[model samples]
Target: MHASDTVDEQLELAADLPPWEKLASKARALKVMEEANKIIEDFPTWEYWVFFLLFMTEFFLAVYVSINLLK
Candidate 1:
C-alpha cells in the first residue's frame, strides 16, 4: 500500500538518527534540576507572599459563592 511505503520511510529515517544526550543522562538531568532550583530559590520572597495571599483570597471567595448558592 502507498501508506505503508511512507511508514517504512519514516521508520528508516528514525533508525538512522544518532543518539542525542542532551536530557538523556542522569548527570545532565541533575544539572538541569539544580539550575531550576537555583532560579526558583533566587526568586523574591515578597512575590511569593503576594501570590500566596492572592490564592487564599480566591479560594475563600469560591467557598463563599458555593455556600451562597446552596442556601
Candidate 2:
C-alpha cells in the first residue's frame, strides 16, 4: 500500500530473478516461440470463426433495432 513497501517488494523480486540477458537469450527465445506456436496450432479455429459470426449477427441486429427505434 505504501511506496516504501512497493520498492522493497520490487527489490526482493529483482534479487530473485536471473540476469536479463540470460532470460532473453537467443536459444531461449526460439524455444519459447516454438512452444507458443504449438499451443496456438492446437486451438480450435473453426469454433473461433463460429463465435465471430454469431457475435457479428447479434451486433448488426442490435444496430438495426436501435436505428428503427430512433426513426
Q: Which candidate wins on TM-score?
A: 2
lDDT of 2 by residue, 4-71 (tens): 23333444545655777434443454565567778889987998999999999999999999999999
- In candidate 2, position 18 carries an lDDT of 71
**TM-scores for the candidates:** 0.39, 0.41
RMSD of 1: 13.1
- Tell me how candidate 1 scores on lDDT: 0.62
- lDDT at residue 28 of model 1 (Cα atoms): 44
TM-score of 1: 0.39
Candidate 1 per-residue lDDT, tens place, 1-71, comes to: 12223433444444545455322343444555667778889988998899999999999999999999999
Go through the candidates in order and give the clash count of each: 0, 0
Model 1 residue 65 lDDT score: 100
